[model samples]
Target: MDLRFDHLIHAVSDPERARHAFADRFGWHTVAGGEHPGFATYNALAYFGLPYIEWVGVRKPEVAAERPFGRDVLRVLRAGEGPMQFAVRTNDIVGMADRWSRAGLVHEGPIEASRVRPDGVTLRWRMLFPAQEPGKLLLPFVIEWPAPDEVRLADLRQSGLSPDPAAAPRLRAVHAVVGDLARLRRSMDAYFPGVLEPCESSEQGRGVRWTCGEVTVFVWEPAEGALRRVLDTVGERPFLAEFERTAGVRTRTAADAARRLEAAGAPVHGLWVVTSE
Candidate 1:
């Protein structure tokens, strides 16, 4: 029952521009990830260790309308740019789904899907989406990659799809601002078990932090002021802000990252912050 953060999906209207921005700011270059057949969507991937960042966009709206998640991606793009959803990786997706279902969680599919890499290697996996509501973005969908870890990494590397471990920013934490912490915790407990630890937020509201792999997931209750405004704008989602450890100690703190990104003309919407720790 090993569950860990897999990747974060950043829905963008223009993949090339977004890719360039990320590369320019964080030295994280993205590679082609091939289109989703029958979904009218395509993606570029910036690999970072085991977890990665997926820059996804709708290629054809008319075709995308046929698929549920595809349509959701289109809608998110319509609003603005930034993280749309996050996923968790599991060794046993079927068993995990069964456990979640038994615990009274509404979800759809341990559905199988595959994508062909630019180098002609096909990658396949099964995914389970917990909860059908669009607002439930904070609830991570489960994914199980069928290929062996070595084979998958090798294939991706051969296709030049892997990130530069030395240059890429290491994800340290993921802050998820939710309207109801208790409700979200109840659902998360079934999948992550004892990972969640209670804590008090700076805003004086209840918060729980879960360590998933090298990344931490923070779920905080709704608060007043700036954070509350952000939650209202983004709705209940898994991503509020991401804290990353830079490749070098010279460039530490969110201000440093923000200054560089701003100089590069990249949008700084509080999505990622650089930390010394």
Candidate 2:
């Protein structure tokens, strides 16, 4: 069972605004991502190599309010803008869902989902969402892309999105805020065995880190109001902060990114600066 980090979902009030803000701060342009039709949501995508950033928001409140997942995303937007959830990709989605079911973990679907690009090419995939729980937000939803691994990047480029492989910041790690470290570790072990390792945080707390291909995921105790919202709704969600490692030695610091975000008027809570070697 090999699970790879797919993309990070950042819920914002305006996908276009979020896209421009990201461009201003990171120097990477986001291409137009089409609407979710029946779900009443749409997105703009900032593509990296494999993992990317998806800035999603509601286009129609009434229709989106009808669905549980749609409503969940909308709630995050209502609270403010920042990361709401992340996803993991697998080649065998059905097998993965079976494993979760056998473990007594409740989940929904291998649901068929698709989006039509502006060029009229439709990209389709299947997804599985875990049953909502205290730490459910910390757990990634499973996704299976139909295309072969090698052509995934090319497919995105063909869909009329500009993915600057050279300028796009590589995702270094995803920081998840959880209540109980031991319990989350147990769940992760069952889903993807032998991936996590105990680690120390620079912020004076303990955390567990795991690598899925090129990206690292860190789960630690909630540190801010935004993180606490992962368990509630008033603040934000499980994604406390995201760190990016740039391609150059003089990449922008967190403070620089914060200033850029502030100037752009985007929510700066869950986003950190880009670090470089």
Candidate 3:
């Protein structure tokens, strides 16, 4: 499996609020996000760069059904604020799982699902989850089949309702806060090997750094004030603003990136869209 970062999911309370936040404020365009019968909810994908942002909301009770993601997705729907979960991209998901299993990081299968676009295009793929709780700084996952390129990520980037010449953002890194930096780092070291660096922290929270190619990942638990500001900013709408922010600082080190986030006062919690140099 060519393991890598896929897209990040920022679960929101009102899918519409999520949509408008991206579309109206940031000028991101939405591709027809498919509907899930099981949850009676609908979602719209804001096709950014390669990884699109999905704004998901709960559906009416009558429409929702009992299914695998039903309860959990509903939980995200209710929670409201996001940076809910992050996704990993892997071309060979099955092989990656085998590697992970050998490394002792318990994991689940690449569950299969499909999303149909308005123009009759269907995206079919499989996904896996880390053997951990959902809320924790999410672990990496895999995506396989039909390759991400065949899906034309760049095409979707051009589909937004309006385009700002400055529309594209370079997502430099994504940071999450965790309780046990050493333990988590150990898990990543065992499974992911050389990718993560030694853990670090401040009065704010524990920090662990992971580097994927040019992208940097810093997992941090910030001070109360920072956390509250993050929640408040995302509670209204999340992904778009984030995607825009991170889109700028594409190839910087995690520490350099975090400093920018600190200056921005948003902290790298949810979706971040860094601007390109």
Top candidate by lDDT: 1
Misplaced by over 4 Å in model 3 are 37-41, 60-66, 102-105, 134-137, 148-151, 154-167, 199-206, 223-277
| Pairs of residues clashing in candidate 2 | none
Candidate with better lDDT, 2 vs 3: 2
lDDT tens readout by residue for model 1, 145-174: 987667777766666677655655677666
Q: On residues 140-223, what C-alpha lDDT tens digit does candidate 2 reach at each position?
A: 788899997779877766654646566556766666556677877777776667878776443333567767777776665544
Give all candidates' CA lDDT scores: 0.68, 0.67, 0.55
TM-score of every model versus the real structure: 0.82, 0.81, 0.73
lDDT of 3 by residue, 60-151 (tens): 64444354444555555555456665676767777777877887777767677776666666767787666755444345655665655645
Ordered from best to worst lDDT, the candidate numbers read 1, 2, 3
User: Best TM-score goes to which candidate?
Assistant: 1
* CA shift of 85, model 3, Å: 0.9
